[model samples]
Target: MNTLKRTLALVATLAMTATAFASCGDEKKESTPKEEPTTTATPEDTTAPEETTAEPDNGDEIDASVKTGGDTFTIAAWNHDDVPYLIAQWKGLSFDTVVEDLADNKVDGIKFIDMNVGGGQAAEKYDQLFNEGSDLDVYFCEADWALKYINDDSKTLALSKLGLGDSKFTNIYNYTDEIGKDQNGVRKGISWQAAAGGFAYRADLAEEYLGVKSPDEMDAKIGNWENFVAAAKEVSEKSSGGVALADTLGGLWQAFACGRTQPWVVDNKLVIDDFCKNFADTAKELWDCGGVTKNSQWTDEWTAAGVSGNCMGYFVSTWGFGGFFLDAAGGENGAQYGKWAVCQGPTPFYWGGTWIVVNPETDNGEEARDFIISATSDEAQMSAYAKAKPEYVNNSQVMDDLIAGDTVFNPTVSGNFKDGQNYFKKLAENAKSIDFKGLITPYDSTIKGNFADAVKENYLDGNKSWDETVEAFKDKVAESVPDLEWDD
Candidate 1:
């Protein structure tokens, strides 16, 4: 059978079972406010105008040794490599040329300083830095830590005051109402880039054994959670004991759970909506089908699985395609180069991203804002950095270059670089703006650790019933947010 025919068969089987057996146990009991479905099929406009190739500006005239008013602009970031990209684009030019063009259009003497902080020590180090009155001008915060930084007020700059609260970087700020904006319409940080989630599977394996071709067809067969697991079961049966995918039940559970809800906690009562139950049951089914690895035993399994070609691709964040997945596959694994591709998962869910914020206490506030404007402008600097690094563009227009360029691979849809970009666009459309107030408390580590442990024990081990697990989750939420009130 051809890939198309097999996929059609799988879809037919799933559609038949969906009405009777696939209803999610925890879907919203109260009808979720209807919004036009965002992920429906749309016609492709593949022909876009080419981007202008302006001459590169390497900072030359301004003396590198000259100090402007004893002002040193310090930027705190987890990725230290971005500093080089900034310097390469704008180093010695006059404040007008560098700051105005690159930074937000200010002309002031400011010495650039970049700090490298590891991701593991993010919150602790940031807190210490803020408390000690470090002369930091800019900082990057992850999704979970964004609320902590914004709520503290004194630790960071109020972007509204700095004039960056209304940036025009459509992709980064495009979904502000949903992801980046606070309850009071305060824009604390701008999403600099994103790592979208999609299914990466072996095209050759699917073609030869399973018979799958186009992503649209794949969507029919394995689009949502119910169909995805059913397809995995069929793949497992066909492979005869070989792992269908390279993920553990915990990892799969997290992806599905996160995808199903607005956020993990809403109004403080651990959201036990039908989606949650559906996600848990999906994990249970995968576990029963021998489709998952244990959390403790995936390292060697992942390594061997990648090299052996027996396993199908696993769920991957967009950034992981370049950073983690490519690195693990040894960067251009000969014949495996074009064999892998991406497809939309059951639902749109974001995995990872970083937001950049300016510090209000800085003496060079104007200069800092200028720098931010230039760095984040829809111009080439931001686009180039995204291209060179394993980073996704926060600017929608930067995607033009990405789609036109040959370097970035689109594993979901073969021969279509726009595949990932389209996926993110849809995700942004469907996403509900989650309130981050109680999700990341001051004691972030403790909260995350406890939640991770509970998820592993209850879902992975199958030790607790759904009701019991939800009750435990509620207790954990109460421990974190003592004053939280649910609408009940």
Candidate 2:
């Protein structure tokens, strides 16, 4: 038989066998923590909810042998490598290894392509590829757009279809599994990193302004929105109005939106829940106190806030800590390099994550499956991941051991950063508190952007009242999702 034809037959056989194991009890969903402030679920709600590993024997556990006879396969994602620490730490023994092993002809004739969908164009390209059915064999689905893909089985296939036992994931974090699964508890994707977030603050500024720079003391000060505002007032008073409490207005919204009590669209109706309304109030108060500037996120000004000491800090997740935000915080040797600390500021909110998914349309499912398992589930690879880099990995057991200092991933004190404090402890605590089980919607990207714009224009800059701002918001959301229904 031809190689392509044989590949299809094998994948079909594997899918059938995987479905036979579908009844595994470990598929039981984790109950969303009732006390979580980020989301209040009603069963049908879809909530929108990182990591590295090196390979010692990952190939052994997952049988990471490359399938030689399949058609050339393509995987699309936002960057060259979303998580560099993992790739760097692995030193060529991971998904990278699998691809290398195959590309080097150690295997057979499989063609692997890493489609670098530029950061700004990823969502557009992903949607385009699905619409055109352009051989999207493997792809990464981000948290904001995950629900859309999960619900569309045309694009995603359930992992249980591989007949892999839940035993493979006993150590996985409940939230990771929860997000990857559809409403029926069948997982279609998986992540290797836990992108838990906290307030990344200038420890020096905390002491200079709040009179205490340590996380514990600072945590007490900006523990909640009210306390945060009070601290902002202190900043305005002390910095002679030179520094704002937060880096930008966008930072405040980033933290606030995660604390939302319900999805933007609940039950086919556009409802503004308590959390949404509270943002208006909180933003207004911040404006009054000079707590936040109008700078947008990802802009030069916003990035400069962390470095210039013009603002106290940023609300960034573990990914930000490992790359983006940390890089923005003046790299490892920048001025203020060692003056940073993180804490659970006011809520348990996840900023970002990338889920590994397979395109059901591919003739390479078997190979795709092995890649997913190697990157996300292989124990040896995950274990080596911790020692190579300091990431809040997704495996609960792995994270627990890492938290207890099981790996060589050490927090450096050379520069006296946070006084050599281990920030992973706080990261683990914050990661566990997340419970956005049914509060996700695919349109979050649109709604979140519109809402932020509405607030910035009407309330912050134009002097519109909260009610007027809500009216503007409704007009905007209605335009974006014309089919959506909202209550008066």
Candidate 3:
């Protein structure tokens, strides 16, 4: 097929596949108050105007008309599972500290509103809160959700206007330039945590079976995809096909497919470039080498394989490493504790992290901004980190502290937590943000469905040739993002 025709065919295939699995539903809601436009200013200066009124001494005494009660700052977030680290800390602290701290500071209340939404429901809930002008103070959303909210002009409050502009978050901007700026060079969102992507392995197994003594040596053996494959083969051979490198396909695909040039789509066109193909091919090869497990269920497969000590390692996000794997290793339900380690993979990729945004319609816009700044400040960030180390963003000092003080060991590598942190930090330095405009088209849900099916067909179904898989991806993209175009 000619290149243009080939590309078009691929897009069509992906589009059809994506739509098949797309969820059809809207998010539910809890009632609140109406919102009024606080103030407006030029994009150049986003902070709100200073208040002439003296700060209230009693958090409860603040003007109810403006602030949402000193005791009541609602946090809109997805499922309780999304922020495990935060949940752990909050639960461990008995939930009183969050309230008492706010009250003691003369702040009224704090409420964590769980918006049990997932997949497409998440997107819908986000719109309801921001687009529809619902009354919410703080929004906790993933990168994809954050991208959509920030682009919608009416929904979000610009951080710069809250006096957090350039000065307060300089360190965040410097660490990852992508999060600090929007498409228009405007600062829209701030990362609350950094999702450093890497490989988590069974260190005890490596040492026992493969004679791998340390993380540095193991990392050297599987430094990149090519090396990783070789190491996987060694592990498989050593273990007599008892332990594979990964249990699922999605994690590995994400690790290598994400690129710096652009998102999965560009200008309404699907982008099925070398990156995607390479990732698919790598996965295919690993499957062939008996380096991957065959279970399709994520949590179940992860639990069974992890606890059984049946896999060499798996690709995971930084937070995932801390929350999921850590629990698997140490918790009562955990079976792999003290047997794992972490290492950076071939490419730098981020899976999940949240951003906190303000509503422009809130009456206490200035106060809201200050609150955001304080919450994300170095002091607060460090405190949050101390309580829950989920690879958070903001304040380089806090990140440094977490990395330096971490002692958790990864099962994949033969070293302690510090070694894994260094590897993850290095990968984070090269990580890039997802460009919402480029990747998420009107048919985003459809595209995701098609892509998921295509992956299943190519990987699970009878062996498909590389060319055939590429052709399928191209067709899928064309169908899902018909208006999308690729720049020559």
Candidate 4:
């Protein structure tokens, strides 16, 4: 077959195969760590003024929004931050617009249904819309659960359907491409940011405790797991139990899960590799060593620890730095604003990310294509995005500019987490280390959770023996996923 025919044939096959997810009507919700947006920082930081966004003159004008008979291009998510990205990118404005405009469908000449559901409740709503054969235009999928939807051709439309080609995705991280590709290798989605993680530590804490003077010096104190533990011991002993090493158990869990080399399941049977066991042992070790604070994840206490200068640092992805870490440090105006720095912690693992997905049958195809391309592909918009925040944006070209050592840091983020240093240089290097080839599974969310539960039961609490804990975990997994095959 000729190239066009071959491409068309592939698109048709992929669309049919991937639709299995929502055929009975459901889109995938996040099974991965949820991204905390830069909006979470504070009242002032979240709403930077409109006059600040200076559009780059890179000369790539995206095609106009879909001109329909007043049809609103509906996009849904569980949060309130994503829609503003679209509107701002479209209007080429600074990070100043009110998200309420999209929420209430008040933007002129264009209509939008920026429906946001509460956390953990988006899946059911997506299913309801799909079941009712709604005209949903664009949506998002997270790293952990994206496969559930992307592997279903019948439920999703390939970006090719809107004239997008692989060329548009050339600069995105390879792992991102691996995750967003359909089973047949057709690209189905694109993530505008790369969620590479690092160690966000208090420069003051590192210096006061370990005498580590810079991010590089601090990295040596805990660059690997062994060093990390040794450093935690040092932190505990030196602080006289005044400071805890762990911000929370979940932070370590995020780092460990993504660095796995094997699948959680192999041929329908569960496989708890050495790394997972080590993760369990290590989590408990951190807890016992008084290496962690007692505050729960996302609690005000946990977040406040960073600003109050209590917890040492966190293991988080790129978004974590700009999102939670940025919030915890307080915005530029807060006390600990410029005191935080990032380095590679224990292992290089990615955490959360947002990928844009589409509805093939919607009438808003042009708008969808334009938005995706502008947000992800157009260099001009990406440059603007990088200039607005220190996210490890998916585009390498922009990242190079960001790393140029002084020019690309966003002025709006006056807190300047890295103190004008391109910390992403380390992140960009670390991004290359991730390989998700055999690591992911459809049941990742449940299996990962159960394993953590088992660890908490056996190691953390001692309520169950190791073997008993594992078996109970297996039992729970079996119940949640009836088809999960055992190793025997």
**Lowest summed-lDDT stretch of 10 residues in model 1?**
12-21
User: Which regions of candidate 1 deviate over 4 angstroms?
Assistant: 1-70, 90-117, 165-167, 171-179, 266-268, 295-300, 328-330, 334-337, 404-452, 478-488
User: Which candidate's lDDT is highest?
Assistant: 4
**Candidate 2 per-residue C-alpha lDDT over 1-488 given as tens digits, one digit per residue, 9 for 90 to 100:** 12222112121101000000000011112112223222211222222221112223232232233222356655567664544334334335454455455446453434334455544356567888878878667777766567667766766766655434476677776667777776556677788877777787888888888898588888788877778888988898889887887877766666666665456665666666556666777888888777886667767877777777787777777666655566556777787787888887766666667787777666665666666666677777777775655456787777777668734364442243566666767777777776656665545656776787788899988899887887787666555644444333
- Candidate 3 Cα deviation (angstroms), residue 200: 1.5
Model 4 over residues 313-400: C-alpha lDDT tens digits? 8776666655677777775667787777788766666776778888655677767877888878888888777666445678877787
RMSD of each: 14.6, 11.3, 11.9, 13.1
* Worst 10-residue lDDT window, candidate 3: 23-32
lDDT of 4 at 86: 59
Better of 2 and 3 by TM-score: 2
Worst 10 residues of 2 by lDDT: 15-24
Ranking of candidates on TM-score, top first: 4, 2, 3, 1
Query: For candidate 3, lDDT tens digit of each residue in 293-384?
Result: 77553566665777777766767765565556554454433455555666555554556556776665565554565555544655554456
For each candidate, the alpha-carbon lDDT, in order, equals 0.49, 0.63, 0.52, 0.64
**Clash count (model 4, backbone only):** 13
Per-model TM-score, in order, reads 0.70, 0.78, 0.71, 0.80
> Which candidate would rank higher by lDDT, 1 or 4?
4
* Candidate 4 wrong stretches, greater than 4 Å: 1-72, 91-95, 104-109, 330-335, 389-391, 408-420
Off by over 4 Å in 3: 1-74, 79-112, 130-133, 173-180, 259-262, 327-330, 380-385, 388-393, 405-453, 478-488
User: lDDT tens digits, residues 1-488, model 1?
Assistant: 12222112121010100000011112332123322221111122222222223212222222222223425666676654454345434443532244333345242444343335555457667777778887777777765445556554566544555545443444453433233434344565666565455666666666655577755666566766667777878878888867565455534643453433233333332334564555567667777786664533236666346556656666666556654455334455433555565666565444556667766566666555556666665467676665544356566566555655644434433222223334333322222221223233233333333444555578657568876665555455444443333322
